[model samples]
Target chain A: METVKFDLEKHTLREVNQYLHSDASVLDGKAVTIDNPNGSHNIAVGLKADVNVTIQGHAGYYAAGMNQLANVVIEGSAGTGVAENMMSGRVHVKGFASNAAGATANGGLLIIDGDAGLRCGISMKGANIVVGGSVGSFSAFMAQAGNLVILGDAGEALGDSLYEARIFVRGNIQSLGSDCEVKPMDDTAKQILVDLLAESGHGDVDPDSFTLLGSARKLYNFHVDNAGDY
Target chain B: MGTKDQLALVRDPFACKPAIIAEHDDYVAIASEFRSLAHLPDIKNAKVFEPAPKEMYVWKL
Candidate 1:
């Protein structure tokens, strides 16, 4: 039940990060509050403890990048690469997020309460992402594995060149990407959606209302027959 | 607003392209400068080389 506070407006980024790094293990299972982030890049990067961090204002690029066993909550909007390459734990953005949100993260859950920009979940390995609002184009591009659940509309070329990743969109998708196609939502898929929605605190949304998109397996081995689709 | 000569002079000369090699256990390794490979599954070891600032690192995790 310990609470630690860091004021970014009055401190250097390195100093703040140094304090966090030194105290990460000591303050494990505690609550940390970062005030006046003001779109600072690399805030709280490389955290590996089991704790909770709250950023009061907007965060710049790579906030909570490479996170593991920690819960990071951004009270305001986030810039590019939030929660990028996260190993485990959770990252929640209360406001909108910029491009590349949760890019290449292997595990954990990223919940965005507001809209997300382009390339969300691109190259993700195993993370589960839920967006409460719409997402920009090229989301889930080149994703090898994971689940991206978008409650709102998806922009153009969603899930291009994807592999094994599951995408659930409640609203209209502008278009499908190369080798990406819509798939029927089976009972297992519906159950997964239900669990994801519940985990994201959006249990009210109907899982049946969403459409699933995944890889068409056309570019798996990259044959000359499917060169046009590549 | 600057001339080409001035721009070239000011441009960074030591800017070598950054790259990452993420060798995963059961999946194909990913090599990208734009993407991150820190979260890849079953990582036995890792090595990083930085031309700028001149640093080399090896991590075992």
Candidate 2:
């Protein structure tokens, strides 16, 4: 495969992004490495083609925003909005990520090898996020569709106001958000979890250790009886 | 459709915290309490509001 490298100390974010945009067709089957990122934001935003991007250091914010058909690997941590609004692709972070790791993403696979901060999968739409460590509060807030597999403890208000999305957490859940309830893991759900963990390169994790959380479906409509919960 | 769904589309819920705006010789760096302006590359310098909670903090670099 073709390999391209960009040194953030020498090249600006605009120049790097411009190169990817201009050479869209040529970069489809290539692997690009970014060095000396030094916590720069928006490093690989709006990538539309299939490419492999490897970031050597920490990313500031929105590291892979609106990404599609790309495989992005971050050797270090990521800031807020790691894969925000992502349509499709894969983002693997070897270190911890800050808040809003996959906010509003439509589709893709986000694998975090370390702890994730608040709102880890907020408003997620169809994406699958696998966190190898603990996650902060407000995770899966307003998540309409997707799967969030947390291998460690979850903070308060986990999966608050969640819809359709299924959450699998291994450790203690501080609390469940409104309308989110613990569900028994079925064969189908367990298999799905197992597959996801394997796909995210954590095949050793036991799916049986997870407890499933999903929408109760009782608060879909605003009924007066549920007004207090609302 | 739902309150949570609607709230997700609104402006960041955690904007009331302190913000930092550093203007250097070459580039300007802004750090809001909750949100980040690093995605926008064109902005140079300007007044930034916290949008809610009415506490103001700024730094000139």
Candidate 3:
């Protein structure tokens, strides 16, 4: 396998990303390693190739935002909005991620090995996120689609104003947001959880231990009975 | 509350600010950004994590 290496301390982020934005034919199937990331923002944003990028150190905000068909791996913790608005491909964060991680993704897979900060998947349209640890308050808020799998505890008001998206948790939930209700785990849900675990290298986790939560569909319409004055 | 001999840390309940904690065998450090700590000795081997909101942590010296 061909590999491209860059040291962020010596080269500008623009240079590295510019090389990444080169024609797909030149960048496909290549392994790009970025050394000394040192908490730089936008380390690998808007990559359209099918290459694999590895950030040697921590990443700052929007590390892999708007990614497509690329695989990005962050060796250290990621700042806010990691993998936000991704269209496709996979991003794996070996350390914890900051607030609004994986926000508004369209299609892709985000794997966080450590805890995620607030709003893990806010307003997600389509995508899948697997967190190996807990998430902060208001995770998956106003999500429209996709699946969020949390392997650890969730803070207050998980999935507030949810829509269509399903959240599965293997640990404790502090509280539920408005219009969010627990759902019985069926065969399909179990299978999905099983597949997600397998994909994220967590197949040993028992699928039966997870609890499913989804929208209650109570906020979709206006209520006239509760109208105090009109 | 802690004495000068102890190392303590805390996070806001809303968690709007950023904080990362790095613990090494020799010492423990906390910073708002990783870049500030990137020059530390043996940083790659440190255990890095974000402190939970509204939680107080104290490391005895």
Best by lDDT: 3
Docking class for model 3 is medium
Best by TM-score: 3
Give the alpha carbon lDDT tens digit for every residue of B1-61 in model 2: 1242221112233331333343445544455421355333543233322222233333333
Query: Which portions of model 2 miss their true places by more than 4 Å?
Result: B1-61
DockQ-based CAPRI category assigned to the predicted complex of candidate 1: incorrect
Model 3 per-residue lDDT at A211: 96
Query: What DockQ score does model 1 reach against the true complex?
Result: 0.02
Kindly give the number of clashing pairs for every candidate: 0, 0, 0
Error of 3 at A123 (Å): 0.9
Ten-residue stretch with the least lDDT total in model 2 chain A: A18-27
Model 3: runs farther than 4 Å from truth? Answer: A224-230, B1-4
Residue lDDT tens for model 1, A6-91: 89878888987776676556868889899878668899888888888999866778999998888999987677899999999999
Say which candidate scores most in DockQ.
3
Identify the superior model by TM-score, candidate 1 or candidate 3: 3
For residues A1-230, write the lDDT of model 2, one tens digit per residue. Answer: 98999998799889888876656678888999998776688989998989999988767789998999989999877877899998999999988787889999899999999888778999999999999998877899999998999999998899999999999999999899999999999988899899999998889887888999999988899899999887
Q: Comparing candidate 2 with candidate 3, which one achieves the higher TM-score?
A: 3
- Itemize residue pairs with steric clashes in candidate 3: none
DockQ-superior candidate, 2 or 3: 3
Interface RMSD of each: 12.3, 7.4, 1.1
